[model samples]
Target: MKVAVIGTGYVGLTTAVSLAMNGHQVIGVDLDEAKIVKLRQGISPIYEPGVEGALNQVLNSGALSFTTKLAEAQDADVFFVCVGTPEAADGTADLRYVYSAVAAIEGMQQAAPKRRIVVIKSTVPVGTGDQVAELLSGCPELTVASNPEFLREGSALADALAPSRIVIGAGDPGTSEVVEELYKAVDAPRVVTTRANAELIKYASNAFLATRISFMNELSRLSAALGTDIVTIANGMGLDSRIGPEFLRAGVGYGGSCFPKDTIALLQLAAQNGISLGILEQVRTVNATQPVWFLEQLQPFVPDCRGKRIAVLGLAFKPDTDDIREAPSLAILQALEEKGAAVYAYDPIAADAVRQKFPNVSYTKTAEEAVQGAHAALLITEWKQCVELPWEQLYESMAQPVLLDGRNAWPAQIVKQAGFHYVGVGKS
Candidate 1:
């Protein structure tokens, strides 16, 4: 089947690349002319791991192409809407981008009446598929289906090619079958259901995972007061088959493109439906405060951070990606600046994004330069370079030799042996 993917973002690019590699002719559409130009040159705009190579392969095979106009892919059999639905000011998802994507395709559907099947691969609130169908009610041939993507930022290509599960949500059974046929090449279990169920599944999955992380974070706090090791507690708890090890790692907080927005949007969605999700509300609260918890830990030790230089080891939300959206490093850096501390930050790929946010922040080329001459250092994101820094040289470079492991990336014993005061979350 010929596939047209709207939006050249992470989800769309990965989906287009994966389908093209599977021998489908795919045209990835985006408004950004520069991004389209780069894609045409076999350059991936997104920095997902192992994706650029795959993109080049598909481009070389003449199975994949890109365009800046939606009209270019109007004749395709299937159109996947992968635009972003960022969080609105009122905590709901801003659907303007989604509306625009649908509106552009609605014209094409108007021409032929039953030209193509529109599959929504964006994460949206429940019943959004119905809304799209209603928007293009004039086109009786256009079948709208909800096929929310579950691709992670760094490992997007892997997730797209080998998804854990595939979901097809449509009002008509035929629409569901049509969308499912596009993914017959992908070997994953399929869930065909009502539109609302499929939409809710995407948000609910992220909400539950966020809840588990906050649950462990809450316990990590209690474990600290009782001199109990949270790592061991998580391990013992995960040993039970009912409670898996995923999302059990206690850290600063959950962030990135999904959790923070999805949790709040879910809360707003529940309230709109006259329902209250108390546990999820608490999950959002706990996750928001995790950054401040670092400040609470800092004051007792530093006493006064005025004029002090602090090295921030990482800037991205997680390792292996350049995305800094809702990163804990942002909150940590802002708090440090508020406390009159000079911040020096480093991340292999994410520094450029962080530099725009904090123009005055000392963005260094290497991790060693970031830690050098700093009063103390806080390990924010768990990059491999951060976990395996030359400890002896790092100790010699620091002004105070104080280390705060925010992600608990380093073993306390090793940092102690390197002659630096080490502090970690829920560590006794």
Candidate 2:
């Protein structure tokens, strides 16, 4: 399969690289000249584990290429729109990027008529693919299929190479078969359905995962008040086959490119349809306040944050990625700064990104550097460097040995024995 992946963001690059690795000749198209140039030189613009190495392998093997124009990939058998559909001001998914990609593909089809599947791998609302199909209805040779990606940020490359499932949503049986044939090399369960179902599945999956996190977060509040361990409770609940342990960790909250925006867009979509997802509404509420709630735990230990040196560990939303978009650490930083706390933050990769938004907060190279002489330390993201530490050394160096485990990644028993005042989310 000669695949053309439009947009060189996380999804597009990973998709292009993975497809090329699977022995398909792939051309990655992006409007950005600099990104294309970098890709041409086998340099990945994004920092995803194993993607750049795989990209270099494919590029060297002549399995992959890069282009600034969609016209360069005119003869491609499959066109994947991996563009970002960012949340609009009104909370709906801004589909301008998607529409632009589709229009470009439409123009390509007109110039050189051929059988090609315009697959919408970008996350969008229900009926988006059908709308795209209708827009290109004149071209009988072109097929529009919704193939939503389920790539997590930290392990995006791995997820793309071996996905949990492959969903192909096409209006016609012929289109479905063609799309399925494109992914024939990948071994995953297939869900061949309508375009609408496929689109909704992407949004619904994120929404449900957000709901689970929020549910546990809200439960953690109860656990905190009752002096019960949320971790133990989660483990006990996970023992039941019906309630498997995933996204059950009670943390400050989930923040990333997906969950925060997707949940809001789903709510907005539901509102437009006159369907009130009250439970999901509450889920968002819990998430919005979770970081603040976690910060409130600091009050009992340090009565006033004024003139206090607070060390914030991990600035990224999650572990590996440098993406600080919608990261909880931002909210924590804001609150700390507002309360007159001299903040020192450290992330192995994401500190530079956060430094742009928060110049006042002191950024450090190492977690130890951030916590040095600090009154308290907060674990915002559970990066290994941020979680695992020289307990005795850190305890002796801190102005006050107060540990607030927002993610509950720190070993409470060990930290307690080390003579640090450990305060964890729902850990008594």
Candidate 3:
């Protein structure tokens, strides 16, 4: 199989690499020349674990290639539109990139003899495939299918090869079968449905997960007031089997390119259809305030943050990826800066991403270096390296031994024994 992947972001690049590794010739197309050049050199533009090695292997094997020219991949058997649909100001998904990709490919189809199945790997609102179908109405050979990606940031390759489900939303029966045949190699559930249903599946999945996390986060506050542990509460409920343990951990909230944008898009989609998703709205509301609430808890430990040197551990949204889009650490860092605190931060791989957004804040190579000479430290990201830091060494470096565990991912008693004031969320 020959696959043409449009866009060189995390989704497109990973898709290209995984396909090439799975005995398919893949050509990744992107508008960015610099990114294309890097990809040709076996250097991934985005940070995903094991992607560089996988890309290098495929590139060396001559199975994977990248090009800035979309017309070059006109003869590919399958074209995956792995572009981005960022959130717009009106709370809807801005699908300009998707439209552009479709338009570009449809135009190419007119000149090419090969008819490729165009699978939309980008996450879009429901009925987006219908929109694509309308756009490609002139080109009958170019069949449109919605195959939304569920790749996590750090585990892109792993998730791509072994996904939870491969939901193909195809308006045409022939198109669905062709798309399924390509994905038959993946050992996961094959969910064949209409284009609209598959689109809703992706949105509904994110919305439900967001609701669960937000519900647990709000409950974590009540748990703290009643001197209860959120972790134990989550465990007790998870053991029920009906409520499986996933995204149930109480934390600063979800922040990346996906959850926040998708939930808002869903809210807008519902409102436009004369429906009110009150629960999802509340989910959004709770998530927006979670970082602020976490920041407010730090006020008691340091009344006046002016001239206070604060260290922030983990700048990435979660961990293992250099992605900081809507990261909790960004909001907390902005608040600390506004309060006139000298902020120092460190992440295993995300410091450069954060540095691009916040140039004034100090960045360090190591967790201990970030905490040195700091009045207080807030552990925002639950990175393995950040969690396994030398607590006693950090205590010795800090001017004041105040530790605010934003994710509540640390053990309090051990830090207390190391002579630090440890405050964990929802843990009394």
Candidate 4:
């Protein structure tokens, strides 16, 4: 199948590259000339594991290409709208990008030979595909279908290639079949549903996952108050066949491109319909409050952070990628700076990106360097490299060997044996 993927963000780029590697001819379209140029040069704008290699393979094989012009859609059997739907001030999704992409698709339809399948891969509110269908009604030879993507940031390429399921929501059987055929290479459970259900699935999945994380964080708070170990509690709870642990690990909070914004948008959407989602509203509140709670815990350990050297390990929300958008680490860094702490941070891939956000903070090449001469260390992100660091060596170099394990990635025994004052969430 010849496919044209619009908006070369993380989802769009991964979708295009993965599909091209699966023997489809793919043309990635973006309005940003610089990004398009880089893609043509076989460079990925976002950091995702295995994507650059797959993109290289596809580009070398001549199956993948990129362009800024919307005319490239003329030869495409399927057009995927992967643009962003950022949160508006009212907590609803700002659909400017989606609307712009629809306009471009309508313009390209002028020269197309036959009706083309327009797949909405961007996460949007329920009934969005219907709105898109109405928008493109001017183009008679167009069919819109909702095919929401569920790719995680760190493992986007792998998830795209081997998704857990493929969902297609279309108005008619013909539209559903056309959308289904485009994902013929993906070996996953196929779900066919109405457009509204498909849209709600994306929001509900993200919102539920966010709720779980918030629930665990809230439990961690109570566990800490009672001087109980959350790790042990989590381990025991995970053994239950009914609970089955995933996203149950207690941490700072859930933050990324998806969960925070999507949950808020869903809440706002419910509000607009005069429905109050009280549980989801609390979920959002709990998640937002976690960083502040974490900061409060650290205050007693480092009473006066003024002029103190504070080392922050990990910047990305999670590991294996350099995405800091809505990352909890940002809040921690800001809180540290406000208290006059001279912060030194390090992440394997997020160092440069973090520098862009906090130019005043010191950045180092190695984790050891960041910890050296520091009064305290805070583990914000659970990156594998940061998790497996030589704690004893780090302890020896620091002026004061005080460690705050935010993600609970380190072994309590090992960290305590290293002669450092180890503090972990919900662990006594």
Candidate 5:
């Protein structure tokens, strides 16, 4: 298959590279000349494990290329619209980028009529694919399909290469078959359905995952009150087949490009449709207040945050990714600063990016530096470097050996034996 992936952001670039690696000739198209130049030189703009290496490998094999214009990939059998649909002020998905990419594909199809599937890999609302299909109805050779991506941020490349499922949603079987042929080599379950169902699958998956995290977080508050361990509770619950553990761990909250935005978008979508998702509404509430609740745990140790040096470990939303979009650390940091705490933060890869948004928060070169002489250290993200450390050294260096495990990642028993007061989400 000759595929053209439009908008080389995380999703687009990962899709392009993965498709090329799967024995397809792919050309990535984006209007950003600078980004295209970098991609042409086999340099990936975003950070994901093994993506750049795989990109260079495919580029060298002549399986992949990058271009600034869609006409360059005019003969492509599939045009994947992998653009971003950021959240609008009204809490709906902003489809400007998706629409722009679809319009460009329409222009290409009109100029040189040929059989092509305009695959919408971008996450949009339910009827987005139908709207796009109508836009290209004049082009008899062009068809639209909804093939939503389920790539996790840290392991996006791996997820793309071997996804859990391949969803192909189109108005007709011919369009779906054409899109299905592109992923025939990939080993995954196939869900051939209507465009609306496919779109809802993406949103529902994220919304449900967010709900799970928030449910556990809300339960952690109760667990904390009863002096019960949320970690143990999660493990016990995970033993049940129906409640298998995933997103059950209580933490400050979930943040990233997906969960926060998608939950809001889904809620807004439900409202527009005259439906009220009460449980999901509470999910967002629990998540929004989780950081503040976690901070309350700090008061028992640090009576006054004024003039205290607080070490904040992990700034990115999660480990192995530098994306801080809607990251809970931002809220935690703002609250800390408001309390007059001199915040010191450290993240192996995300510090530089976070430094831009928070100029006052001191970024350390290493986790050790962030904890040095700090009154309390908060584990916001469970990066290996942030979680696993020389306990003795950190204990000796800190002015007061107090540990707040926001993610319940640290070994509470070991840290307590090391002469430091440890506080986990629902563990003492």
Candidate 6:
């Protein structure tokens, strides 16, 4: 299959690289000349585990390439629209990027009379595929399918290569079959459904996961008020067959590119339909307050942080990636700075990016260097390196060996044995 992936953002780039690795010739199109140049040099713009290697392999094999021209897509068998659909002020998705990408594809379709399969891999509102179809009605030879992607940030390559399921939603059965054939080599459950259902699945999955995180965070508050340990309670509950645990860990709420935005968009969608999504609205509210609550918990130990040095470990939303968009660590850093604290932060991969965002704040090359001379340390993201750091070494470097475990990624007993006072969410 000769595939043209439009918008070489995270999803589009990953999809192109993955498909190329699976023996398809892929051409990734993007308007940014600099980005296309970097991709041509076999460099990935985003930080995703295992993606660079796969992309390098495909580029070396002549299986994948990047271009800035839209006409290059005319000969492709499939065109995947993987552009951004950022959240607007009204909580609806801003579809300007998607529409722009669609128009570009429409122009290419006009030049080529052969029918092309256009797949929507971007997360969008329901009926968006129909809108794309309606826009391309003039061409009369294009088929649009809703095939929303479910790739996580850090593990995008792995998710794309080995997805849990492949969903194909189309108005035409023949078009859906053609899209299905593209993933025939992938051993996963295949779901054939309507375009609306496919679009809703993406939103519903993200919203439900966000809801679970909010529910757990809310429960953490109650557990703390009643002198109970959330970890113990969660562990016991997870043992039940009916209540399997995944996103039940209590923390500083869920903040990422997907969860926060999708939850709000879904709630707004319900409101526009004249229905109340009270639970989801509360979920958003709870998540919004979680970071503040985390800051409040640290106040008792560092009441007057003026001129005090504080070490922040982890900047990305999660581990193995340098993506800081909507990361709780950013809010925590801002709050700490507002309290007159001199913040020193370090992450394995996110240090330089974080420095770019917060130039005034101090950044260190190593986690120990960040911890050195700090009054207290806050473990924000659950990076494996941060989780497995030598607590004794960190304690020796810190002026005050008080630790706030935001993600609860540390062993409390070990930290205490290392002569540091440890604090974790929903734990005494």
Per lDDT, the best of the predicted structures is 5
For every candidate, C-alpha RMSD to the true structure in Å: 1.2, 0.8, 1.2, 1.2, 0.8, 1.3
Error of 2 at 284 (Å): 0.6
**Tens digit of lDDT per residue, candidate 5, span 260-355?**
899899999999999999999999999999999999999989999999999999999999898999999999999999999999999998988889
Candidate 5 — worst ten consecutive residues by lDDT sum? Answer: 102-111
Question: How well is each residue in 20-69 modelled by candidate 2, as lDDT tens digits?
Answer: 98888999999999989999999988878898899899999999999998
Candidate 6 residue-wise lDDT, 184-240, digit = tens: 788989889999999999998998888888898999888877888899988888888
Cα-based lDDT at residue 71, candidate 2: 89
TM-score of each: 0.98, 0.99, 0.98, 0.97, 0.99, 0.97
Model 4 lDDT per residue over 283-338, tens place:
98998889888878777778999999999999999998788888999998998899
Q: In candidate 1, how many Å is residue 153 off?
A: 1.7
User: Candidate 2, after superposition: displacement of residue 371 in Å?
Assistant: 0.5
Kindly report which residue pairs in candidate 1 clash with one another: 114-141
Model 4 has a clash total of 0
Candidate 3, residue 268: the lDDT equals: 94
lDDT at residue 127 of model 6 (Cα atoms): 90
lDDT of 1 by residue, 1-428 (tens): 88899998988899999989777899999999999999999898877899999999999899999999777787698999999999999999999999999998987777655557889999999989899999878888888999988888889899988999999999898888888888878899999998889999999999999999999888888877898888888889898999988889888998899999999999999999999999999998898898888667776568899999989999999998888899999999998988889999999999998888888889999888999999888999999988888899989888888888888888789889989988788777
lDDT of each: 0.89, 0.93, 0.89, 0.89, 0.94, 0.88
| Cα-based lDDT at residue 420, candidate 1 | 91
Q: Over all chains combined, what TM-score does candidate 2 have?
A: 0.99
Clashing pairs in 2: none
Model 1: lDDT to the true structure = 0.89
